[model samples]
Target: MLRSHDKCVVYIKSDDGEKVVDEIKTFQDAHWVSSPKALWRIYEFNLTEMQPAIINLQLHLPGKQAVCYWKKQNLQSIVESDFVHQTMLTEYFKMCPIDIEARTYLY
Candidate 1:
């Protein structure tokens, strides 16, 4: 089990339904906010002014990233050119899909 210093609960599920793990105190050791520029754009949208909208947005972001790969559309370049298009893309490839079975047999 892992726990955050702030006492936030984190859960991890395995591909097989056999393992259900609970995480207890952890630290924000990594910078999840990959692009500061993108975050700044969100701030520019004045989310603080719209409390409900901001809350809803935060809730949906993680699920959106999981099924979508936004990294393929070359977001870094796009953001560099236009600071406004910083929102995560829904149709782009965020990560390369891996074949677990193939990897297991390799070594």
Candidate 2:
């Protein structure tokens, strides 16, 4: 089955990184970056629907600027992006064949 949820990362930056991090926790999960380059993987909303919230990241942070990175993705691409996850996922696939087809079944 096709995964309908979109993915994104919200970068919240501030002179007060700690405060920003704490304040940011008030928001929903699966939307903020996990790395230093300001990555946020937000699955709370689909691509077009999430644009406004991503834009608001800039306004939401205190005494700093923010950014958002959004990418359309599939299971393979998501797993491939992370090395450790990729390794484990590759192993899992070797042991158990994925019932989901690699691509959409279409004309």
Candidate 3:
């Protein structure tokens, strides 16, 4: 289990969001949003535990990158971006999918 200090927000987008959300639900301490988009979902998990989660995403959603996003930074940007109901995460996520995943994995 991930410690409190490791808590972070995760935005998972797959060709199959429902399946991904279902898969994520099996993870410890994961909480999904009440509503889900057709091909994307938002969740929160501990930083350390997320590796396996990403691995699972790769296994199940092959060829898709599992991106990890920082809640506070993006949250600030989300608030500053346009003032919507946290949809900025999804929009920005879609805009820069490679970036979110690359930096997290490479750096």
Candidate 4:
């Protein structure tokens, strides 16, 4: 999209007046109708292609993991729940002590 000695003229409008600027840069507007990516987005097509993908692993200390509850739920009951105390990190720690296979892997 760019070539040597190529420059673009931009006109900016403000409360004061219109100002003209000359700059050499790459400008892309995905929301514009002229953009192919905009058409793909409008048709609900895949926008990105990634290899292996991405994953989120939650790590927290004991009794410090996140908990989801409704407004009507009692805080005391939620704190006492078994699921509230367990997290992926805590489970891994528990498994490493009992399962010899788990001890072989690094955290």
Quality of model 2 by C-alpha lDDT? 0.38
lDDT of 4 by residue, 7-105 (tens): 333455567786633333323421124467678889988767655444354877667788989999999999998988887678878999899987976
**Model 3: CA > 4 A from native:** 1-81, 85-88, 97-107
Answer with 1 or 2, whichever has the higher TM-score: 1
Better of 1 and 3 by lDDT: 3
Best by lDDT: 4
TM-score of each: 0.17, 0.15, 0.15, 0.44
* Cα lDDT, all candidates: 0.40, 0.38, 0.41, 0.66
Better of 2 and 4 by lDDT: 4
lDDT of 3: 0.41
Task: Please tell me which predicted candidate would have the highest TM-score against the true structure.
Answer: 4
Which pairs clash in model 2? 8-40, 8-41, 8-42, 9-40, 10-40, 30-42, 31-42, 32-40, 33-39, 33-40
Error at 102, model 2, angstroms: 19
The CA lDDT at 40 in model 1 is: 70
